[model samples]
Target: MTQNIIRWAQMDDIHDLAYVYSESYRKAYVGIIPDEFLDQVSLNERDQYFRKSLSEDKQKIAIMSLDEKAIGLLIFDFQGEADLPENSAEILAIYLMKDYWGSGFGKLFLNWGMDRINELGYANVFLGF
Candidate 1:
């Protein structure tokens, strides 16, 4: 049987997180966004962003692994955006490897994120692109 897990992401997972972010972003945005722009989505830049953002107090990241291999990422802010309600949480990003698309893992991660946000005392959620 295949085992799937969603767990809190740590600094050590930065590289995989970056990979999922850039790869999925490219796959999802191709044609819709400018090719030149999508071509510039570097893994190193994403890695650096995760390195800095992962340390923030209100930000949370989760990794979705299937049989011990990381294939998806979820990023959210428990403190939410300034324009949102005080008790809201914001979903900053969610990405999955193109290979895993339509396999239902994306919905799983979203449900998990919502549960986590509620557990953290946020009564509402705002999804940001």
Candidate 2:
């Protein structure tokens, strides 16, 4: 059996997060979004973004691993949207490798995020696609 784990993302995880974020976006949105838009998705940019975002106290980023191998990324905000209620949390982003699609890892990963929100005492949640 594989060891599935979900844990907070750290500085050491920036590269893997960027790679997974870029590849997942490309593979999942290729046909739905414009090629030019997709072409602009750069791993370097994502790396820098994660580097900056991870330093912020309000944003939370998590890594999904199977047997110690990084396979997905989760970004959330405990504060939720400015326009939304104060008692809510927001799921800013979620993505898993194409190989893991339809494998149920995504649902498990999402549930972990929800559980975090609930643990934080949030009564409502919002998800950004």
Candidate 3:
């Protein structure tokens, strides 16, 4: 059986995390987002973004793995959009490799994020995408 796990993302994870992000986006948003924009996405840019996110106190990013190989990424925070309730938390991003789709990992990750949000004392949560 696969040893599925979710843990706080670390600096070393930026490379694999960025690959998952870029591939997942390229697969899911091909038409919705301009191909040119998606094509321009790079691991270096994502690495820098992850670095910045890790520096912020408000951000909580996690990595999901199976048998020690990372397969997904999750990012959430207490900050809400202007249209959302002030006390609500937001799921900034969530992504899993295409191979892992429909295998219940997404549900597991969502539940984990919700549990974290509830633990943080937030009564409501919103997922950005």
TM-score for each prediction?
Answer: 0.95, 0.94, 0.90
Clashing pairs in 2: none
Model 2 per-residue lDDT tens digits across residues 1-129: 989989999989999999999999899998899999998899999998999988775789999999888899999887666788878788989999999999999999999988988887889888865
Residue ranges of candidate 1 with Cα displaced over 4 Å: none
State candidate 2's TM-score: 0.94
- The CA lDDT of each predicted structure is 0.90, 0.90, 0.85
RMSD of 1: 1.1
lDDT of 1 by residue, 1-129 (tens): 999999999999999999999999999999899999998899999998989988764578999999988999998887656789889888889999999999899999999988898788888888887
Best by TM-score: 1
Tell me model 3's lDDT, rounded to 2 decimals. 0.85
Per-candidate clashes, comma-separated: 0, 0, 0
Worst 10 residues of 3 by lDDT: 50-59
Model 1: colliding residue pairs: none
Model 2 per-residue lDDT at 16: 91
lDDT of 3 at 119: 86
Candidate 3 total steric clashes: 0
